[model samples]
Target: MGRLGRQDVAIPDRPSVGYSLLNMAPKHVVVIIPVFRDYDRARQTVAAILRCSVPSPFSVRVHVVDDGSGDGTAERLSEQFGGRIEIIGLPENLGRSAARNAGATNISADLLLFVDADCEPSDDRFLAAHLLSIREADVSMGVVEGQDDGFWHAYQQAARVRRDRLARRTFVAHFTTQNVMIDARLFNSVGGFDEAFKGYGFEDRDLAIRLARAGARFTIAPGARVIHRDTLDLAQVCRKMGEAGATTSQIFASRYPFEYRTLGYEAIDGQRHPWRGVLAKLLWPVFQPWTQHDAWLQWRLVPFKLRAGIVRIMVAVSYLRGTLRRHR
Candidate 1:
C-alpha cells in the first residue's frame, strides 16, 4: 500500500471520449464504489477488492467517492487503506449520480466498474470475469447472491436466476448500479449518469437506457459475482421505493415518456389508472399495517403466494402514491 492520498476531482462540461469497440483489451480498470456514510461496508469491500486476483496485462485501482457522508468516513478509509485505494470526499451530499460521475475522473482507465458500497466480491474471479466480459460486450453486469428477506430479498435473489448462469454473455435489458462495469469512454460519451436524478431509483435505469441508445452492448458476467448485504423490511423498502417514485419517477417519465408507458408506469401515473391510486388509498389501512411486524395480517398465517401478492401491492401503492403526490 502506498501513502494515504485525497483526490480532488472535477468533471468538465460535456466531455466526450473517442470510444473504440475493437480494442477490448483493458490495461487499467478503476473500480468506482460510491458510498454515503457506509464506512464498515466500504472498508470491507475495498479491502476485499485489493486482495482479489486479476489477470495479467491489466491492473485494478479502487476509487471510492464519498457522497456527502460529512462524517469523516472518507478520511478514515484513507487512513486504513493508505494508498492502496483512492478516496474522494465530497464536501456535501451530492446525489448518487453526481457522486458516481465524480469518481469517473480516471481518464486513463479503460474500464470503470461501479460496485455499490454494500456489496462484496464473491470470489477471486470477480474482477477477472468483468474484465473478460467486456471483450464481447460494451457493459458487463455482474451477478449477486444476497442475505435478505421479504419481497426485496426474493426479488434481488430472483434477479440472479433470471439469467441462466450458463449463459455467461447473456444479453440483458435492465441495468442497476449495484454491480456493473462499463467502458470508460462509452460511459463518458453518454455523459455518465444524469445527476438530475436527485434521490435513488431510476438513475441506474436512466443510465442504462442512455447507454443502450448509444449502442452499448450489455452482458451478464456470471463469474463476476458479489454478495449483496442489504436487508430491509417491507416498510423500509416502501420508503426507498416511495422516495424513488417521488423524486425521480417523473424525471424519468418526462425524459422517456414512451419508456415510462411501456414500463407500466402509465397504468399508475397515467391518466387511465386514477382509480387504482384512489383504491390504494382506500385500502391503505388494511395493507399498510402489514408493513409492521405485528400487523394483524401475519405473514406466518397467510399462504406464501398471497403473502407475496400483498407485499407487492403494498409496495406498488407506496410507489404510485408517491408519484401521484408530486402532482398534488
Candidate 2:
C-alpha cells in the first residue's frame, strides 16, 4: 500500500532490486490481536494463529488485548487457549490505536506482529512467511484477501491490484495493520500508533511515514496472506469514509497539509470549492440511501458502470459533506 505522493514520504534509497537483507532471520515473535466486542471472531483468529506451523512455537507468544469488551472474553480465551496465549483486558474502549499500544507494553519478543481480530491467516505457513520476510526488511506487511464476495470485497481486492506493480520490498507508505510485523525496537522508537487519530483512515499511513523517515525498510509478504472475514456494503464503506473525513482527515490535514492536498481532498474543501459542498448537500439525501442498502447494489436493471459511477458520487458526497461539516 505504498501510496507515496509526489512530495509525501521520502524513504532512504535502497540497493537495486529493493530490499537489502538487514540481518539473519530472528526468533521470538509476539503476535498482538486487538479485540473489541466480538469474542467469537477473536477466539477463532487466536486459535488459527496458534495452529500455524511456525518454526518455533515456544518462541512465539500470542497476546490478545480485549479493548473494553467487559464481556467474559478474557476468561473464555484463557479457558480455551490455557497457557498458550496471554490476555490484556482494557478497562474501557481505547479505540484501535491505543489498544494496540496497550498490547505492545513490556514485550520480550524481538518481532511484534499485529493482526486484526476479524482476520485469520490463509494457512499454517503464514507465520513462517512473515518470519522469512523480516530477513529482508525492518517491517513485513502481509497481503489481505476478502471473503464472502461483494462490492466491498471487490474494492479491497481491486485496491491490492496495484501491488502487482510494486517491488517486493519498499516503504511502508501503503500499510494496513491487519497483518504486519515490525522490529520490536523500531516500533517503540516511533511511539507506536498515534492515539489522536480517533477513526479509520490515515493512521496506518501516518505510522508508515514516521517509520519510513526513521529509515525502516518494509517488505511486502505476498505469501503470508490473511482472510478478511468482515463483509461490507456500500453504506458501511461510505459511513466509514465520512467518519474518516470528519475525524482523522482533520488531524491528517493539520499534520501533512501538502500530502492531504495531493490525496485530492482539496477538491472537497468547501472554503475553496463551495459548489462541491452545495452539490453534495443536494445529492446526499437521495444517493446516501442508495449507498446505505444492498438492494441498489444490484445492477440487474442498471449498467454496472452506471451503478459504479453513482456509488463513487455518493461516496464523494459523503466525504465532502463530512469535511464541510467538520470545518463549519
Candidate 3:
C-alpha cells in the first residue's frame, strides 16, 4: 500500500489520449463483475461486458466473482464463457462488497470497473468511457436506466435522482454496485467496501463517503449508461429497504457518529425526530425535479396487474412496519 495522503484532486474533463477507438489499448484496465446466483442475468451481464466495444487500446480482463450462489451459476458460466473470463466462486454469500473485494484482490490492474450482475451497458463504449474518465479521478460512476420494473420503478428511480439533487452536499444519488470503476490502489487504501452490509443498500454510499473523507476524487461519467432490471416485487422491495435501513443505522452509529443522522435515523439536525417524520422527508419532494419527471414516467409506464398488486402489498407492509416500530 502507498502512503496515505489527503488532498483535493481534480480530474480533467477529457482523457489525455486522442478519441481514436482503434489504437486505445491499456492492459492495466480490468473489469470486475460480482454476481450472486442469478444464472441467466449474470451470464448475460458477462456477455455484455465482454462484447462491449472499448475504444481504448487496453487489454481488459473480465473477472466474475460468485458469492456462493446455489444455483447452477458456476456450471453455466464455465460452460458458456469457458477460459475467456475469470471466475472466483466463494464458499458463502458475502453480499456485493465482499465479492467485489475478492475480485479486486485477484487482479493486478491499476483500474477496476465494477458492474452488477443485472446491469448491462447501453453500448460497447461504456468500458472505454470509464477508462478515459480515470485520467482525473479515483472512481467513476455511470447512470442506470431501468428496464422492466415499469412506472413504480421509474418513480423510485426519480425519487433517487431528486434526493441526490437535494443533498447539495458532495453525495452521490446512484452509487450502486452497478456501472462503476475505481483505482485499485485507492479503493484498497480506504479498505475497499465494508463487508458488514449483508444484503442490498447503502454500502456503496458508505464507501463513497469514506472515499471523499480520504480525499479520493470521483467523476460522474454521464455518457456511459447501463440498462438495469430491478424487478423485485413490492414485498421484497420493502424487506430489502428495511434491512438496508437497519444495517445502515448500525454502520453509521459505529463508524461516523456525526453522520449517523444523515443515514435516515434522524434529521439533518442533531435531534432524533419522531417516526411520523414522513412529512418532513416528503415535504421537499416537489422541489425535486425528478418527482415531476417520475410522475410522467409512472403515468406512461405502469407495470402489469400482478406487479402492481405486489407493489400495493409491499407498500402496505412498509406502512404497517413503520407504525409498529413507532408504537414499540
RMSD of each: 8.3, 3.6, 8.1
Put down candidate 1 lDDT per residue, 47-86, tens digits, no spaces: 8788888888889888899998988899999999998888
Clashes of 1: 0
RMSD of 3: 8.1
Query: What is the per-residue lDDT of model 3 for residues 1-328, given as tens digits with 9 covering 90 to 100?
Result: 1112222212223323232222323357777888887878888888888887766346778888888997878878989999999888899888788898899884677777888888888887888777777665667788777775666565556556665753443244445568888766667777988887665566786786666665555667877888886564444555554455444545544565444443343332112344434443453333234322323334434444544454443443343333333312
Query: Candidate 3 — which residues are off by over 4 angstroms?
Result: 1-26, 257-328
TM-score sort, best first: 2, 1, 3
- Identify the candidate with maximal TM-score: 2
Task: Name every residue pair that clashes in candidate 3.
Answer: 11-136, 24-56, 24-57, 25-56, 25-57, 25-58, 26-57, 26-58, 53-124
Which has the better TM-score: candidate 1, or candidate 3?
A: 1
Clashes of 3: 9
lDDT of 1: 0.73
Q: What is the lDDT of residue 85 in candidate 2?
A: 93
- Per-model TM-score versus the true fold: 0.85, 0.88, 0.74
- Pull out the clashing pairs in model 2: 1-174, 2-174
Q: Per-residue lDDT for 69 in model 2?
A: 87
Candidate 2 lDDT tens digits, 48-165: 9988887753278899999998878888888999899999999998899998988999877678999999998889989989987777677888988899565556556555654443
* TM-score result, candidate 2: 0.88
Ranking by lDDT: 2, 1, 3
